[model samples]
Target: MSHALNILKEVFGYPAFRGQQANVIEHLVDGKDCLVLMPTGGGKSLCYQIPALMRKGVAIVVSPLISLMQNQVAALNEAGVDAAVLNSALPVEEAQIVEQKLLAGYYDLLYVAPERLLTKRFLDLIAQIPLALFAIDEAHCVSQWGHDFRPEYRQLNVLHTRFPEVPRIALTATADAVTREEIIERLVLHDAEIFLSSFDRPNINYQIVDKINSKQQLLSFIQHEHLHDAGIVYCLSRKKTEDIAAWLNTHGITALPYHAGMSPHQRALNQEKFLREESIVMVATVAFGMGIDKPDVRFVAHLDMPKSIEGYYQETGRAGRDGQKASAWMVYGLNDVIQQRRMIEESEAQTQFKQIATKKLEAMLALCETNSCRRAYLLDYFGEPVAFTACGNCDICLNPPDSWDATIAVQKALSCVYRTGQQFGAGHLIDILRGNQTIRVVDWEHDRISTFGIGKDLPVKGWRAIFRQLIALGLLTTDSDSYGALCLTEASRAVLKGQKKIFLRQQPEHKKYLHKKQLANDCPILDQGAQQLLDQLRNWRTETARKHGVPAYVIFHDTTLMELVRMNPQTKDELLRVTGVGAHKLDKYGDHLIEILRIA
Candidate 1:
């Protein structure tokens, strides 16, 4: 344990271990298997990294994405650690050289994707060398029902079967009780210890808004709060990602599109640009962020609804990774709900898969419509219930919405569905209720129904919210044919018969987000001269990173720079005292940093 602490300070440059990091590292060093469920940026890598450096031979890390592996390996190299990655992205000669180094015991850590790890040739080669430990990242991918399911991950049970003596650790950022169990079962870690950290990201402010002209709403949010910040915008479809990216770019936002539809070269190029540059928005689908380790993402906005709470949590978790203030902003509407349900109904997955997926989606909808604390609901969903009802960080706690007695509105909507023969979509029904004599309504003689014009007092947008809530509350469902036609569910009977009352949440008027909130990461503790020093230090870091062919944050995180400006360390010894300055980093960049601080 003492030696581990020394390494944490000497190699990793952290003064102390956070939460269960120390315990997890000690357990792995003791040659025991375990499963870790730490949040993103909670120091999960150090659990195995310290053990890998202290243990006998080499640690084999099974990752899902080659880009992720490259990022980690590059950061490790910058930290003066011997790390290498073997993936299809490498040239044949480079791969062969890495393999040769592995045989010669040259690297302390080697990262490989599951597909490459399970290859017989690679497995056979590892068998001939001394093994240290096996670390599986993004272990939620092993669950068959997980959001990011990869079939190859299910085959990782062989690690324990082949190398029974080696300690193995499976790590993930998001998983429910069911998915968690599946991870343990699939990874064959029944006897392993479990370390579950709190899933709450206190640094993130949760905000959900009505989808009123989604593109414009998104533009407004970004323009007001994150115009000059780095963020991610997630779309539901490939074409939407591209369209949104193009739209944002035209609006003067430095945005790029990323999805599976793009060619490998283009995708890589866009991703590289996002990583290398600052103040860029990445418009992407769910495929873009599994292994992204970028820590400066100020926000993650969902333009459409995700398939499940797990997916929502995973995607939103990418923000505020550096423990800075970030936002998880979303705009969902009736179409997003219908679209998610229709996709599930249309999928080729089996009955049980669909059932669980439906339940998960319901939870997500309830979360969106809830007038209570959003953060508490999120934490409770993962079985980490908080004692407090209001977290004060989410929009609900900041500005509570009103829950109107919507029973009459709901009854009117349900009756209209019944009188219209339950074959019409919400748009047509809303039109008929608002007394719009549309050609289709007139052609069908729908304007003559008693329910027609009944809801004239309510605006179109108001009715849209009520119907959206009804569908979300399971009082209504789409037709089995995957059409947009609204059909009353069995649960709708009570409301239609006036036996049960309904209360629907009404979105509060847009609160003008303050300009200070826009720069949540801005450090007020630093005066004008100190702020100038920070900028100069950033310029130096950027040049150094460019020379090293790595991202600026890889050289020193923004948080570290803030600390440097505050501390103003003058000597090499004083510089080493600051956080994130390990021995190797101190030796490599300490002189430059000292000079920068000295001049100030």
Candidate 2:
């Protein structure tokens, strides 16, 4: 443990372990297999990394993405750790060099994709070298039930069969109970000790708004709060991703589009720009974000609902990774629910899988509609206990939504559904309730029904909210047989018969809650002179990174730079005391930084 702590401080520039990092590292050092379930940016790497350094031989890390392997290897090397990566992206000669180095025991940590590691050539090479441990990153990929299931990950059981003596560690940022069990079973880690970190990311404020002029709302979010910050905006479709990216660019935000539809090189270049630039926003589908290791993402906005709570959690987890204040804003509408349901029903997955997917979507809807602490609701969904009723961070807790007796409104909506023979979706039902005399309404003679026009007091948007809440509460279900028409379940009978009273949030006017309060003092605030100093330091960092052909963060993180601004260290000795300034970094940049501080 002492050795690990020393490496952590001297190499990674952290003074101590966070949460359960020490315990996990200690267990791994003792040669025990382990499973770690931690949120993004919870330092999962340190759990395996310290053990690899302490053990007798090199550590082999099986990662699912080439970009992720490259990013980790780069960061490790920057921190003075001996690490290398082998993937298809590597040149043939370079791959041969890495293989030879591995055979000669020249590397401390070796990262390889699962497919490459499973190859006979690589397997033969590993057999010739002394083994330390196997670290399986993004371990949820092993679960067929997970959102990011990779078939190659399922065949990783060969690791246990071929190298029974090597300690193994599997780590994932997002996984529910089902995915967790599947990871353990598929990876043959049944005897591994499990370490579950708190899934809470307190720095990220969760906000979900009813979709209204979504593009404009997204623009407002960026302009008002995160104007100069880096963020990720997620869209459901590839076309939407491209459209939004172009839209954002026209609106004066530097944005890029990324999806599987684009060429691999294009996607990689866009991802690199997003990582390397300070304020570039990447609008992408679910294809992005799995391998992103950026710690300073200020926000993650979802223009559409994700497929499941697990997906939502993982996507939102990308924000505020540095433990700095960030936001996860989502705008979803009734159409999103219908689209998700239709996708699930029309999917090629088996009946059981479809049912599970439906339930997952339902849970996501529940999170959107809940008037409680968003953080608590999200944590509870992951089977973690929340000690408090309110998180004081989400929009609901901050604004405190007002609930009204929506019993009468719900009854009218349900009655309209039943009167229409449960054959109409929300649009038709809402039109019928709001007394819209459309051709379809008159053609079906729906205006003549007793429940028709009864909901004229509420507008279409209000009625939509009521129906969405009803669906979320399980009082109403979408029937795929009827083309996603509204159907009442047994729960709806109670509301219709006045046996259950439904209290729903009174739909706010103008969507004011979507605007989050700008956090004051979240980051280090500088005086006029110090602010200039900070700017100069950033400029220096950018130039240095350009010279070295690396991200500015690889030179120094924002937090470290902020610390330099605050401390205003005048000498190399004082600069070394900054949190992230280890011996290697000091020797590299200490003189230049001291000169800047002295001038400022």
Candidate 3:
């Protein structure tokens, strides 16, 4: 059997096993069951993948996503390993062929869906094989508390009970303490070794912006910061997904929308297009989750707020999965909070369940409003230590926002609601501030109300900011059933009565960058010939990766080339010392890159 560290270098192209990977691999090889709670991009696949190749028989991988399964299978095939996935997309003949391959021992790993486990034919076939291990990907879905709960996942214990001697490993990128315990119970890993890697990805910078012309803000961010990077823009609804995707396409971005509203063939086609293409952005909804396995996603932008932190974490984790620098950005507003609360309140869940869900939703809101180090807060929440309080990548860090005491402004807004019978939206009230004397105000004859036009002290934008912040802070609530008409919740009563203080942060004006001339001055690496060499290496890597049908980094990592830039190596022996350059890889690719460097 190959050593786990060596396997890391050979198959996955890493120089060393990340924290807990080696330990988990050892436990798996020793035929002990394990539950691994690794953050996304933390290399959870390696723990079972290495053992699958080294041990006696096929490793059955139960995966939740068909597209993700296909991506992984393609990657394995590119690495010169035999792998196949059985999913709904397969034809009868193709399914039989894969089944026959499994029985004939031609495939090292078999990716199957949970629904396939209960089939008599498949179970009988599995009984005949000398099973090496069982791997459950996205195992958090087994629990109702999890963001991506799957009813079929609860039936996975059959694999454990029937193949008691075989080792099992359950893996998930996002799971809190409750979900973790639920996965163990549902999977029946009674004696399994548990591997809990710190759920932290330091390379990702998290930022949340209060919703203001959110589409324009998204466009500006993409144009300025992520012009050449692969990204995913998440919307809460299909219409918005399509609209944003169309907007991006109109503005020279190669973008597509994927949601259940699209035809299945179109969804599959769009997903395939994203996987095969470079620098493409996918604008999608929550329906696009569970099966997306694209590495090197530069950023994940949430145009609308998610239902819970677990959902947000899992979605954002898709970025920086290659362990490179990436970002997570969100735009949120008062309407999102109201709609989310209404959904929770209307659900058939018991009061306790609703309370738990509400708490999680509030936590997500707090994450949005927090002005502290986005990275530090996120990492600390996931149970990790961060030495720095400011990460310098978020909106709060880049341009620290100033706050003003809005006690009076909030009182005016709330008083207007109280005097107007709590039945007006933001636009109607904003008109009163600017003294529009509109027809509605005239009909109500409310232009003479005590609080009418009282907010003239602040700009229209300022009022909008106060209202949004107030709504987010739970001091005011919007009645969504009434087309988002503003209302004073019980929490708002205190503020209107001057029993509490109100503070609102100032929003920054948007800056648009119109010239690429600044690009040459932006990257210090551009001045050096080494960067040109690195670009050539990346180009060659992309082409070579396309030829092999794998992610570009799988062939040779960017970190490795950046090291080469620093080391300026000219010999194969020298190149091997660079991180991520394995001996097997050195023998295969070292000469080519070394030759290119010499020419440069």
Give me the candidate number with maximum TM-score. 1
lDDT (Cα atoms) of all candidates against the true structure: 0.92, 0.89, 0.80
Expressed as tens digits, the lDDT of each residue in 1-600 for candidate 1 is 999999999887889999999999999999999999999889999999999999999999999999899999998898889999999999999999999999999999999999999999999999989889999999999988899999999999999999999999999999999998999899999999999999989888899888989999999999998878999999989999999999999999999999999999999999999998889999999999888989999899999999888999889988989998888999989988888888888899999999999999999999999989999999999999698999878889988999889899899999999998899889999999999999999999999999989999999989998989999899999875838789999999988999999999986887788534645545466679988999999999989999999999889999889889988998888887788899999999998999889898
Candidate 2 has an lDDT of 0.89
Model 1: per-residue Cα lDDT at residue 584: 94
Candidate 1 RMSD to the correct structure = 1.2
Candidate 2: residue 284 lDDT (0-100):
95
Model 3, C-alpha of 156: deviation from truth (Å): 1.4
TM-score of each: 0.98, 0.97, 0.89
lDDT of 3 at 457: 75
Tell me how far the alpha carbon of residue 144 in candidate 2 is from the true structure, in angstroms, after superposition.
Answer: 1.4
- The reply for model 3, stretches above 4 Å from the true place, is 289-291, 346-353, 383-388, 433-435, 508-528, 549-554, 560-600
> lDDT score, residue 353, model 1?
95
Can you give the lDDT of residue 234 in candidate 3?
95
